[model samples]
Target: MDFERTNPIERDAYKNFDDSSELQSDIRFDQVETRLLRQQQDDEYLQCLREDQEREQRKTQKLLDIEKLLANLCLDEEEHQKKKEEFVKMKEPMLLAIEEELSKLCLEKHERDRQKEQLDKMRKEKAPRIPVEPPAGLPELAHLAIRLPNGERIMRRFRHTDKLKDVFDFIFCYPNAPDWFDISVPLPRRDLHCEGSTVSLLEAGLVGKHALIPKRLRLTTDTTALTLRTTPSEEGLDNRRDAC
Candidate 1:
């Protein structure tokens, strides 16, 4: 039997081929590990970017909300101011009218006060005056007879120093005396009814000069005769004169 002989070169060549195959397999394993690590890093980066974008969107939305609230407050303030102005305009005329009415009332009150003052003055002027009393210790007295327009005679005593105004006040106090009349002396034809007359009875020749003897005198209205007569025992008969 003949056996085939193995060559050394061929055997070595086979060994080299086996070593190259193992090296190639180790390189492929390294490449796969590197690729896997790189993909994991890329995924982590994408996740971080998404989180930042969401945070920025939330911040922007908060700013927009604050701006909207500020705008609403501004609108409310403007509307309140407008309403206040409208209310003032509506009440202005009413306020003016009230002022005018108060002014008119004040004027009316003043006018009423003036009218009341005038009426009081007129009443005071029309009122009767009081008679002044005669002084004491006179030496003479006049027995005067006053005759009214209705033919009524009244007797009274008067002092020599009494003014004619006293006689006029006495007549005014009478119940049935006329409101307006004139007194006059008949023999001399002298009027004695002057307003505010200050002539005394002695000065008008109506008082007796002697004591304890009264002079007789007649005081008459417009329709009666006024006369002065004294007793014969009285002195100074020619000195008795009419002073009216």
Candidate 2:
């Protein structure tokens, strides 16, 4: 008991040293916890920044792809237009040649049509006149005495309603008839055959008694005069007179 009382100072010193060591240990532990929290925050921020950068890179790559596609489309369109122009140029001469040939064919066809028309007109002019029959049951008759180019005379009888073409046919069948001839009345100087074959004998005022003089056309220098003969019954002694 006396020894313990005498060492009180030493015991108090040891107690103070232990309290100081415990306080130091608590401060160190707090510092370590703070440092660990700050490090975790920094790591999270860095991860977010890396993610943002990756998104921006992907967006930039997409824009580049779109631009490349547009450029390729423009190039293809230009090439197509150039090919179309070349094709038109290649066909130009052939199209013009076809049009020219068509025009030439049209002109040739027109010329052929004109030549055919001329030929038809010439044929109509050279063709003989067609005869038409007279109306039946007519009592009146026309007596015609025709004088030939050689001063010979022939006589024939026809109905008043008969066409002048009938008289022309009768003369055309004669043995001594000229190849081409014209018949005329002397007093009035009216051409009968050249007027029209459709004219009736009554319309020409040749109903009763009439006389005609024939003039022959000479086709060559050696042409002969037309001569005609008639039977005694058909021959008339009537004097020549203009019926019209």
Candidate 3:
């Protein structure tokens, strides 16, 4: 028929060839898609493995830090216990020494109390002796200069007939006299007792130029009361004493 017009067989062959080419192309496209999918899966698997490795490393580092903290806490607790033990050891001897000192003080106090009781008993048993009155012929007034232990002189004018208690009262009542003192004279060196002596100053030999040493006596008792008595020796009274 016509060269440009297709024959049925030729047309049919051409159609078959086109169909085969399309089929081959479709097969190749499918194979390329499958390969791309497999490669994507492999990349996903590699990323997951990298992430797991990082997580494992972080966990191991945290565990190491926790172990270090625990070790430090253990060391601090041990040091605190050691210091407490040392303090206890040092305190023991100090406590023992304080107890011993208190015991010694108690014993000494007991001894002092015993001695005080004996002196009190003796003072209570003995009756104070009555003192002699001033002699009948003595002058009415006597000018006396009494020197003290501190090198100070007390100038006084007194009645010869005045009681020895009056002279002592004047001395104790003096502004310069201490709260507690004992009166004595040198040469005879007699301690004047200040209790209940009714003797005159002239009879007690406290008149004229006499150095009446007022000795500062330590208080043996709690009482602030003063006790004085003149010596009973007539020769001691008769001696004229010089300035101290």
Candidate 4:
């Protein structure tokens, strides 16, 4: 007690000292603090792991979409190939068919042309021949008024007119028949005659057909023996030859 009185720090410490109170009160252990800090670090690590997992899922989805697109492209390419093959198959047959049709037409045309030529030759060979002169000379006065190629009126006369209609039945002769003309048919766009045009009888006998004149006829209408004739087309007038 005397020593405590002499030391002021010991007196204050003795005055607060309580023998009944406990020494440990609300104190945290170092091991427990270290464990809590470690738990906090683990929680941070789990959060980072979750974020990484979500990012990976998004990336995987993108890859799946790309794969699907690639698969569709492949399918489209296959379909295109199939369609192209089908088109070629269809086109080939059509082309062959068209070629066959063209060949058939060509062959048919050639055969028809050949037949036409043969028929034309037969008609020419079987056609009856005409004579350019009259038989006994009743009256020989024939004249031809022609519209020239230059659109001019040119007159020509043949001495005699022959009615060889008894020889050839198929003849288109109208008006005055010429001695050198037996058939006078107008060609299209050819104006060789007009209304009231006097075509000589002698020239009408020779018509469009080629004929050989047996002899020339003298005009007995006016006591004048002027050999005047009318012919529509004189294309075959020089075909006259002496008939024995």
Candidate 5:
């Protein structure tokens, strides 16, 4: 009924207004849908950021643990080196002392061996000759006290007819006697220099008429050689001679 009374222009205007209102409603609905879609995309991006942050935290913690383990290993290595150094220092002096003791023992053993060899040689040379009766008619056995280089006094009885060389032979035949030597009379203070083969004890003045009193004879080793003899005063002290 209202459409019949209205003019064509007015109806046309009302229809256009209704169409405009429907179009506005449609635009508003589309705007709301777009806004909701944008909100969902933003939420997903925030979740992704949170996941990345958590992964980064875990990686950082693992790196820190590795660093701590490395630091502990370095400390242990340093301690081991210090202990090795200490062991070396403690062992050096002990090794040196042991070496020194071994050397001393070897030297002592060598000295003992040398002394034993010398003693053995002396025993094999027919040592300690016994006294025996002499041939008759030679001035009833003259007794004499012979002093050796080692301060040992040897007592022997000899015949006046025996050569002076006999006394020298008996004394020099003893063990540990020198290669060359000289004999001197102590009481008369005279050196005996008689020829060994020709001179007799009576000619050399070594024996007396008495039998009980023993004459003292000094035996000295020739220091350098038999050819070289210094003054009689310096013979016993300065030269490499041994005197009794």
Candidate 6:
């Protein structure tokens, strides 16, 4: 009965409380807006740091790539040097065989010169024509075997080329020809590794020179075409020191 009688005063107090609460809520919204703005600015800084970290990783990866490339280049250089050394080693035996042959030829020429001198002096004296006799094989020359210098035979044999007459007259004819004749031969048509192979050229040129019997089945270059050349087989050439 009291609430009903004082209901208008109670309604007025309630309306005043509701208005104050709404005002307080508006103030709280303002404070939250300020805090959110600051947090967004902090997040921007974190994002920048993440980007920098990613960029550093990219730089590190690039440096590693460059290092790998450098390593590969070094490896290639080492391989090239190794190949050069191998080529020099392969050439040594062939050179020695050539030099030995040259020494033998020189001694023969010296003996020939001495013989000519004796003959000329005898002719100047007007002596009666004596029956010409073959000189006994100079014991020294007899010792010199064509198959091998040290009297050891090898598996392969080499002969001079017919077209090599000009080569002999031109290149090997030099004073060193008897000493350092490195005869280049032609490769066979069917031989593998003919390109830059000395043995191929030697086999072809020799077969063409009547040094070796030419057989359809034998390893031979096309003498007519005269293609590639390669180094001679090491052990074989070492045995045939006279082939040069």
Model 3 alpha-carbon drift over 4 Å, by segment: 1-140, 222-244
> By TM-score, who's the top model here?
3
Model 6, which residues run further than 4 Å from truth?
1-19, 31-35, 73-244
Q: Which is better, 1 or 4, measured by TM-score?
A: 1
Q: For residues 80-162, what per-residue lDDT tens digits would candidate 5 score against the true structure?
A: 67755665675688589779989998986776566445434533442343234375456656666665544455667777676
How would you encode candidate 4's per-residue C-alpha lDDT over 1-244 as one tens digit per residue? Answer: 6864568888766655643232221122223333433554466568669979998998799678656644544347688677657657766886898799899989867765664454344334433433343433334534333322122333333444434332221121211222322222232212222221244444444343122211112223421111112222222222221111
- Candidate 2 Cα deviation (angstroms), residue 216: 1.1
Q: Each model's TM-score?
A: 0.30, 0.33, 0.36, 0.26, 0.32, 0.21
- The 0-to-1 C-alpha lDDT of every candidate, in the order given, reads 0.51, 0.56, 0.54, 0.39, 0.53, 0.37
Better of 4 and 6 by TM-score: 4
Q: Which order, best to worst by TM-score? A: 3, 2, 5, 1, 4, 6
> For residues 199-226, what per-residue lDDT tens digits would candidate 3 score against the true structure?
7877877665444556544434323232
RMSD of 3: 58.5
Q: Give the runs in model 4 whose Cα sits over 4 Å from its true position.
A: 1-76, 126-244
The alpha-carbon deviation from the true structure for residue 230 of candidate 3, after best TM-score superposition, in angstroms, is 13
Task: State which candidate, 3 or 4, has the greater TM-score.
Answer: 3
> For this target, which candidate reaches the highest lDDT against the unseen true structure?
2
* Candidate 1 local Cα displacement, residue 84, angstroms: 74
Model 4: lDDT of residue 176: 22
Clashes of 3: 6
| lDDT-based ranking | 2, 3, 5, 1, 4, 6
lDDT of 6 by residue, 110-131 (tens): 7656644543453333223212
Indicate the residue-level lDDT of 54 in model 4.
95
lDDT of 1 by residue, 93-143 (tens): 758977998999898677656644543443344335434444445457765
